[model samples]
Every structure is written in C-alpha cells, then in structure tokens.
Target: MDGRKSLGNHFEGVAARYLTSRGIRILERNVYNRGGEIDLIGQENDTLVFFEVRYRGEGSLATPAESVTFPKQRRLLKAASYYLHRHGLWNCNSRIDVVAISPGTVKKYRVQWIKNAIQAGF
Candidate 1:
C-alpha cells in the first residue's frame, strides 16, 4: 500500500485497540463496497457500530472528527446501509460512529469516540 493508506491503517489499528480496551468487540475492519468504506465494524453492547476512523496529525487545520463532512456522512450512511442489507441485519440496532485520533503532547495520541455521529437518511 501507499504511505497515506498505510498510515491510515496504522491509525485504524490504534483506534481498534483503543476501543477493544474499552469493551467493544471488533468484528471486522476495512469493510468496503461500491457504496463506500467503513473503517471498523464492532459490537458495543447490543448495538452494531459502523466506525469511520479519522486521524489528523499535528499542525493539521481540522480535527479528525471535523474531517467527516456532510458528503462524507452521506457516503458513510450508504455504506452502512449496504453493510446491513448484505448481512441481513435490518432488524438489528445499528449506528454510525466516528473515532477521531490526533497527536497529543502528553500522550502519544488522543482518541475520541463519538457515538451516533451520523444518522441514516440524513
């Protein structure tokens, strides 16, 4: 893979590890289709979460969460819908989540988990 993609995968790993430590069971990663892509798929309690992992290094203007704009949100919703239909998970409760990561001075990285970051059909 290229440098940017490799870095993204690394951050996704970081996000996954962080979430796993907090009791979320990761089911899959890099889930992609014609619609779009989901960085991570995991279970949190009874909720099926579709995570969009975003990472912004130091000096970046926008925070990781801010990078997920309106267009990005629409694409994520489409991808999440495809995922649910493909897995026959229509009856299951699900939500789109954002894992925002950034470099921190004290800690190596700062991680923020935003639940229900995007709603379907929005």
Candidate 2:
C-alpha cells in the first residue's frame, strides 16, 4: 500500500485496540458503501457506533479531530445511514464517533474518543 493508506491503517489498528480495551466489541473495519468509508464499527452497550479514526503526527497543521470537516461529516452520515438500512438496523440506537490520535508529550500516543461527534443534520 501507499504511505498514506498504510499510515491510516496503522492508526485504525491503534483505534481498534483502544476501543476493545474499553469493552467495545468491534464488528467491522474499513466498511465501504455508496456514500463513503467507515473506519470502524463497534457495539458499545446497546449502541452501534460508527467510528472515524484520524491521526496527525507531530507538527501537523490540524489536530486529528479538526480534520474531520463538515463535508466529511456529511459523507459519514450518509455512509452510516446506508449501513443501517442495509442491515435492517434503522430503528436501533446508533451514533457517529471519532477517535483522534496524535503524538503525546508524555506517552507515545494520545487518544481521544469523542462520542456523538457527527450529528445527522450536518
């Protein structure tokens, strides 16, 4: 794979492990639909979560979470909608989440989990 894709996969793995440690059961990864790509899908309690994993190395202009712009949020919403419809889960509890990763001053990496990060109306 190319450097960018490889780096993204690495970060996704990091996010997956982090979520698993927190008791979230990962259902899928790298899901592609007509709308866009979903980095991770997991079950946390009774909610189905769509995760967008982002990474910004040291000196990047934008933080990892800030990089998920409005347009990206729209696509994610569309993709998540399609996923729910396809799986007959339209009535279930679901939300879009973000996993932001970056270099930390003390630890090797800093991970931030933002719940309900993308609203559907966007």
Candidate 3:
C-alpha cells in the first residue's frame, strides 16, 4: 500500500488494541460500503459502534479529532446508516465514534476515544 494508507492502517491497529484494552469488542475493520469507509466496527456494552480513526503526527496543522470535519461526519453518518441497514440491524442501538491518535509527550502516542462524536440527521 501507499505510505499514507500504510500509516493509517497502523494507527487503526493501534486504536483497535487501545479499544480492546478498554473492553470494546471489535467485530470488523476497514469496512467499505456505498456511503464511505468505516475504520473500525465494534461493540461497547450493548451499543454497536462505528469508529472513525484519525491520526495526526507532530507539527500537523489539525488535531486528529479536529480533522473529522462536517463533510466527513456526513459521510460517516451515511456509512453507519448503511451498515445498520445492511445487516438487518435497523433497530440496533448504534452510534458513530472517533479514535483520535497523536504523538505524545508522556507516551509513544496519545489516544482519545470520543463517544458518539458524530450524530445522525446531519
């Protein structure tokens, strides 16, 4: 894969491990559908979560979470909606989440989990 994609995949894995450590059960990764791409899909308690993984290295202009803009949120919403519908999960409880990763001073990387970061009806 290209450099950017490779880097993204690496961070997605990082996010996966981080979430798993926190009790989120990952069901899928790198999911592509008609709407857009979902970086990770998992279950947190009874909620089905669609995760958007964002990464920004040092000196980047935007924080990893800030990079998920309005347009991106719309896409994620659509993608998540499609995912829920495709699997007969229209009534399943779900939400879009974000896992923002960046370089850290205290550790190798800083990870932030933002629950329900993207909402529907956008």
Candidate 4:
C-alpha cells in the first residue's frame, strides 16, 4: 500500500488496541455510507461511537489531530447517519471520536483519543 494508507492502517490498529484496552468494544472499521466514511464504530458505556482515525508521519507539516476539518466532519456525520439508519439503530446514543497517532521515538508511539470530537444533528 501507499504511505498514507499504510500510516492510516497503523493508526487504526493503534486506536483499536487503545480502545480495547479502555473497555470499548469496536464494532466496525472503515464504515462507508452515503455521506462518507467513519473510521471506527464502537460501544462504550452503552453509547455508539463513530470514530475518525488520523495519523501523521514523522517530519510532517500538520499535527495528526489538525487534519480533521469541517468538511471532513460533515462527511463523517453523513456516514454515521447512514450507518445508524441501515442498522436500525436510530435511538442509540452516538458521538464522533478522533484518534490521532504520531510517530514515536524508538521505544514507543503516541496515541491521543478525542472523544465527542464532533456532533451529528438529526
């Protein structure tokens, strides 16, 4: 795969592991829908989560978390809506999350989880 995709996959893995470690059950990855795609879907505290996984390679310009823009949020919201409708989960409490992964030093990686990073309007 290309570098971007590869990096994203790495972040997804990291995000998944982190979420799992935090007692969140991941339900889906790269969920595609009419609006756009939600990187991850999970359940935490009886709430449905739509996640966006972002990663920045070393020596890059922008911070990993800075990549999620307004347009991206719109797409994510659309995707989340489609997922909820398709799954018949309209009533499920949901929110968007962002998991940012940055290249770490030789010993470890840095992962940041931003919960309720965006909202979906009905």
Top candidate by lDDT: 2
TM for candidate 3 is 0.97
lDDT of each: 0.93, 0.95, 0.93, 0.85
Return the TM-score for each candidate structure.
Answer: 0.96, 0.96, 0.97, 0.89
lDDT of 3 by residue, 1-122 (tens): 99999999999999999999999999999999998999999998888999999999989999999999999998999998888888989877898999999999999999999998987842
Prediction RMSDs, each to the true structure: 1.2, 1.3, 1.2, 1.7
lDDT, model 3: 0.93
Q: TM-score for candidate 4, please give it.
A: 0.89
Pairs of colliding residues, candidate 3: none
What's the lDDT of the predicted structure labeled candidate 4?
0.85
TM-score winner between candidates 3 and 4: 3
lDDT of 4 by residue, 51-96 (tens): 8998877888888889888888888888888888898999878898
